[model samples]
Target: MLATTHPQSGMVATSRIHRVVTGNGGAAPSRGDTVELTVSHLTKRYGETLALSDASVTFKPGIHTILGENGSGKSTMLKILSGVVSPSEGTIALNGRAISPRTPHDMHELGLSTVFQEVLIAPHRTVVENIFLGYDGPLRRRIEKSARAPLAQALLAEISRFPIPLSAPAGELPLASQQLIVLARALVRLPSILLLDEATAALDYADRDLVFDAIENYAAAGNIVIFISHRLEEVRRLSDRVTVLRSGHIVETLERDGITAERLLKLMAPEAAIHA
Candidate 1:
């Protein structure tokens, strides 16, 4: 268990991570956990404006990218999946179980974690605290308390390129580190479905590559990663399947071998491509 000192309450809180220990001294079962998410006829409306139409798609174990221009319903789709808002009409099924998550916490409990474009962190909190924030789950097969710090440290090392002290205040860190901390928070849960909405915008070339490598490994290990980014190059390099949305509707979904800069631009913005 990692002990976190709350600045406001002055109380020490204990944090726990999910793990399954076996006779071979094996750790949590991360890889080979097959997952599938299916969205059918999902729609969202804000008064008279339809933010998302009747959109439908399925995601398996791998990095699936959502592409679209501004107001193309990409954000709305993610919002619905993350339970930021309720869908006006639709059904979401995970592993063949129908679910309607009413809040982000609800979604988190259902094995879905999201790292939005916004950097969410308690500025005055320590790195360790922020990484394991809101960690409330079933204490089944919990690891030894003494081993928690090293686990947190290992997760940070996997995502961040630099050495961030566990005791350092999160607000004192740079934007890149802050973003990484948010990413670490999401990954700490070992979610079955990880949503990244422009999560790498704050990272530079090298740091982005490191995080990308981690994401690829996570997906390759039989987990689903929903990646949303406007950067074409990043999508080209990271996406195994690309879903294009335009005007609140899904335009197309292209496989890895079918993606191209020109084709993507045309699908995302045909008018802009014509003018150019």
Candidate 2:
């Protein structure tokens, strides 16, 4: 995947920093982390089906949307990125480092967090507890409940449009708010890389608005977010660059200004689209 570079992005080398590498290279360079992620020639197969075929892409400090139809390998790519599934062929690098994560835990350690379409959250736990389930994994807690409560509240304030009671059971929340909670939990630790795989699919109009707000706030913190969705309108509004995939291969990546619904719809479903 070709790495994208921006003036606000690149390695921040200071007194303690010895090496730095910028995102000017086609293949992400190793050293300073101008590029947050790099994927090359990724391929995956399930039985006789080719889930991904020679696909590649990169991640920078902004929002990027992966546009595709059902079974277009968007989820497969996300699994590979989150380390839930292994690519048959490819290499993914982060922060000038290459990794092959065999499980989600590996990604967590890399400061990469994801909220899948299917919720992995515990239903019976309170909202705050659910949000901080793995807080100990990322950082040591000095005062478990006190430290976590305030942090979760602050994160919810930033990401959630409505104030949900922290002590409420997770199962009692509506599905839309639950989805937001999942996303909020992912962002609570301030991960450098975040992935949302069809997260807003189950949301209503109002819920989608809430989700978009969190996504924008997440990106504003100098982090990279991978938004995999079929909604063209949302993708257009949220993505900095749009990456289109068909039959498991990358078709093109259009800059936000260089795109429109007609153009994107055509690229997304060329034969079925009726152009003006």
TM-score of each: 0.87, 0.84
103-216 in candidate 1: lDDT tens per residue? 999988777899999999999998877877776446653444455556667777777778888888999999899999899888777777899999999999988998898888
Best by lDDT: 1
Model 1 earns a TM-score of 0.87
Best by TM-score: 1
Question: How much lDDT does candidate 2 score?
Answer: 0.73
Give the runs in model 1 whose Cα sits over 4 Å from its true position: 1-32, 138-146
Model 1 gets an lDDT of 0.82
Tens-place lDDT digits, model 2, residues 7-105: 455533221000011111111212233447889999999898999999878888779988888877888899999999999998999876898899988
Clashes of each: 1, 1
State the lDDT at 159 in candidate 1. Answer: 72
